[model samples]
Target: MSAKVSAGKQVFAIVKKDVLAELRTKEMVIAMFLFVVLAMVVFSQAFGVILNDLDRVGGGLLWVAFLFMSMLGLNRSFVHEKDEGCLEGLLMSPIDRPLIFFGKMLGNLLFLSIVELFAVPIFFVLFRLEMGASMAGIFLATIFLSNIGIACVGTLLSTISINTKTRDLMLPILFMPVIIPLLIAAVSATGGIMSGEELTEVYGSMRFIAVYDIIFLLVAYALYDYVISE
Candidate 1:
């Protein structure tokens, strides 16, 4: 019980530290927001004639924007820690290494969630799409499940990429292939909701996402200590 409490506090502290630092900089969030919105605006103009018909393909476009925006944010998630030597400091601290992984993962998850929370509605509005409240709940669930897989795989891979000279290039190389399965499921589920496809099929896609998140979360948890040490 005591160990659990300590782990919780350590994780919270790391998350708090990252959040406070981000609030001061306001850099990652703003950049991600701009990128997502800019993608939408560009798509809107380019596909103006088909804006009304976008709902059929809206899920694909939405995930494309989010996937890229998330990569942008993930690329920076560790820059401050690595630059300031905060990662080394944490490594030497009493906190467990797996806790460090959880801390970073949660921070990524929080940032991704915050940006998407606002962006999703704006996305719907921008493309003149409407979703019933019932379907909306499932839509959000699909995105959140996919976000978990992203944060899990992304946090783990980003840590590895940060130490490389070609980190900016390296992250995409390492991250994109691993995340493709989740992306497909997310797009399928979200598109189903928007296109009013069968609920059973959408639920199956969400289940696949949930399984993907769990699998990677375990992989990251088991590997983080070794990953961080080098």
Candidate 2:
């Protein structure tokens, strides 16, 4: 019990540190938000105003924007730590390494959630999506679940890539392929919500995303120590 408490505190401490740093600089969130806006604009232009099948294509475009913006944020997630050699100092601390992973993952999740909170409404307005309240709730839930999966996997991959020579280039290559399953599940769930399908209809995709979150979270937790050590 004491060990568990200590681990929890360590995780919180790390999360607080990351959050405060981001709050001060606004680097990652600002970059991600602007990138998302740009992506939406370009996609809106490509698809044009008379989106006959927005229910089908809008979900894909939304997740594509999310996926790419997430990659941008994840790429920078560890750069600050690496730049200042803070990561090495943290690793040398007595705290368990997995705690660091959880902390960083939570930090990433929080930043991504904040970006989505603002971006989603803008997306709906720009695309002229008219979702019912229930559909809006479901769409938001899908985004939340999908963000968990991205944060978990991206955190691990960012750590891995941060140590590489071509860190920036390596992250997208390592990240995109791994997140395809998540994108598929998220896109499917978002489409179901947009189409006004019953919740039960989209429950399968939601379950898949939930499972993806659990599985990668565990995988990342198990491997983070190794990645950070290298």
Residue 23 of candidate 2: its Cα lDDT? 92
Residue 181's lDDT within candidate 2 is 94
lDDT of 1 by residue, 174-214 (tens): 99999999999999999889999989999999999999999
User: lDDT by residue for model 2 over 1-230, one digit each (tens)?
Assistant: 34444788789999999899899999899999999999999987887854678988888999999999999988888998899899889988788888889999999999999999999999999888898786788789899999999999999999988888999899999999999998998898998888777878699999999999999988987887788875
TM-score for each of the candidates:
0.95, 0.95
Enumerate residue pairs that collide in model 1: none
Q: Report the alpha-carbon TM-score of model 2 versus the true structure.
A: 0.95
Candidate 1 residues lying further than 4 Å off, grouped into runs, are 1-5, 48-50
**What is each predicted model's overall lDDT from 0 to 1?**
0.92, 0.90
Q: Which regions in candidate 2 have their CA more than 4 angstroms from the true location?
A: 1-5
